[model samples]
Target: MGDVFAAVPGAVVDETGLQHLGNPLAEQRRLAAGTALAPRADRAVIAVPGEDRLTWLDSLSSQALARLQPGVGTELLILDPQGHVEHAASVLDDGETTWLIADRADVEGLYDWLRKMRFRLRVDPRIADEFAVIGGTAGALAGVAPASPAGLPLVWTDPWPDVSPGGWAYAPVDPHPGADRDWSEAIVTRDEEARIADAAARGDLQLAGLAAVDALRVAAWRPRWSADVDERALPHELDWLRTAVHLDKGCYRGQETIAKVHNLGHPPRRLVALQLDGSGSVLPDHGAAVRVGDDEVGAVTSAALHYEEGPIALAIVRRSTPIDAALTVETADGPVAAAQEVVVPPDAGRTANVPRIPRLGRRQASQ
Candidate 1:
């Protein structure tokens, strides 16, 4: 693949191994305006080939896939036995192969799991390291002529900022960030990366770093595997059902827990958007305690300075935390007051419409 940082001055690589241009704020604005594109170096692609591929994956993931349409964008999650998200992927198929855009951190594990699960199925899952992902506003690259070492490229448009089929929206507020989200990623051969980067470097095309992309993601209330998730995190808590889940899909490993939670239970915690008091220069890191008064109620999952929202963050707080609670995030600079905005409301589930049992007193009176 292309090393975008090696050829560009003032480019920095992030913790996730992606090249980021130094000017994040400017980049964020440019991208939202469709004037810039981000190289998704924090991600990798895997290709699943064979006639059995679609059906096989459908049997194992949260999204139904046996009849998936080509070029239609969707996503999948592999949940643990407890229905906690274990892995997630943006999925697209190009007639012959199912392309999976996975978090760089989850690639190996997802590959291993697929390989082990392919007992006798004629499917092959292999890394598409030859392809590098470029993300930007919808249709930004639509006019880019194809010149690739791996034939025609594939594209996966994010369905986030919108509720996909069989998914639910917990963000009750109107005019949510996702309402205008236009993120899309296209995969081109590694050779194309340098050309794209060079063009971006020359200002022939605009360039954005990962920081800008992340800020936009946070503003949209999107949940990502590497940054926003923990061992106990559930899809409902992150409000990820907007894109990464299928409630009525066929049984998978964690189906029981998923069904129970959505049908009769609520997530133990819920996601909130935090507008930080940016008086101090410090930005809270992931895992920074989020407190209501002196009591810890949650922790910051992602934090960034939005080009529009100034300082904003995403935190998973106790479900019982009052929706209007004034919270603070514990930062190295002591504490920064955070105003909460609901992403996943405390009453996120109960969709199964499981019948509520009558209280003992009520039942006795009725009897």
Candidate 2:
């Protein structure tokens, strides 16, 4: 069970064999301090170049990509014709071309989709394995600005300025000065999996495990592709108007539906954060029914025992459900008392005012 143990928090420490008892924050700090181990996941990079690259990608994705300048990057969502999210990616422009870094699983499919749509465009898309990607906290990334090691602007592009506040930089794989590297991806022929793992263990860079990363991401209310989205999900439902949809931008695949829903119609569902009552033995799973009294109002999409908070979750609840109403999350163990905590409220874009909800209290209760 050491492998599974290594996968979860408060399990294993670093190569020094130190163990984290039960403190998530301590583990996170240790991981950040290079004392604990963080798992590295697979990533892929796709390169797009030519005269029509920016316009072509802008036409394809929901964000306004054509306006992206070098030394900047943006997160975008690709939706099907039905307005359902298909994939999410970050695009970095290097003045001449753009590079999309996304999950390894979705790379090939995204490439195929882009190829199918490249009718007469002068753009060329190909996989680039020469580069690697790493991430760190805002304070850790001080002097690392995006520049090409190859002297080719196409090879090194700054994808951090536009999206992140000012702490992340994506650079080349070769050695650099004062860099605490996390994960490195080499080409198939020159794979350096063991070396990277050993370096991570040696405290050179912090390892961001999937659980810690997911916890931070969910806490930030960032919508991911597979976890928070699906085939039937609309961009507006996830509160992705600011990042995913360009309301004033020209036509795209599902622009009509998006416009109509935003201007005239209401989104059927809204994404919300739920704070569990902590009294029940049950923990809800994805697709579990969400209820208010006797009415089934929504479904739970994601849940976790937060690092600080006891139990929290993200659920897609019906718009009709009273925003302040008490709801219940049906878990296998039993019905867990929960209340709705709106991360991004329905009127978020309309007004600068945001309503604050009380935090949920947890205690063991009888079934």
lDDT of each: 0.82, 0.59
Relative to the unseen true structure, what is the C-alpha lDDT of residue 104 in candidate 1, on a scale of 0 to 100? 90
Off by more than 4 A, model 1: 143-153, 351-367
Q: Give TM per candidate.
A: 0.92, 0.74
Q: Write the per-residue lDDT of candidate 1 for residues 30-87, one digit (tens) a residue.
A: 8898888788888999999999999999989988899988888999998889999888
Please provide, for model 2 over 1-367, each residue's C-alpha lDDT reduced to its tens digit, 9 standing for 90 to 100: 0122243433454532223435655555554444444332344578888889989888988878777877455666688887778877777777776778776667788888888889999998987655444333433332123235333332222221222331111111122111232311122211333344445445454454545544544544556665777668987776666455667777788877876776666677888877777765456888899998889998888776555555777888887777778788899887877866564455433323444444333322111
TM-score of 2: 0.74
Question: How many backbone clashes does every candidate have?
Answer: 2, 1
Q: Which ten residues in a row have the lowest lDDT in candidate 2?
A: 169-178
Query: What's the CA error at residue 39 for candidate 2, in Å?
Result: 5.4
Clashing pairs in 1: 161-178, 263-352
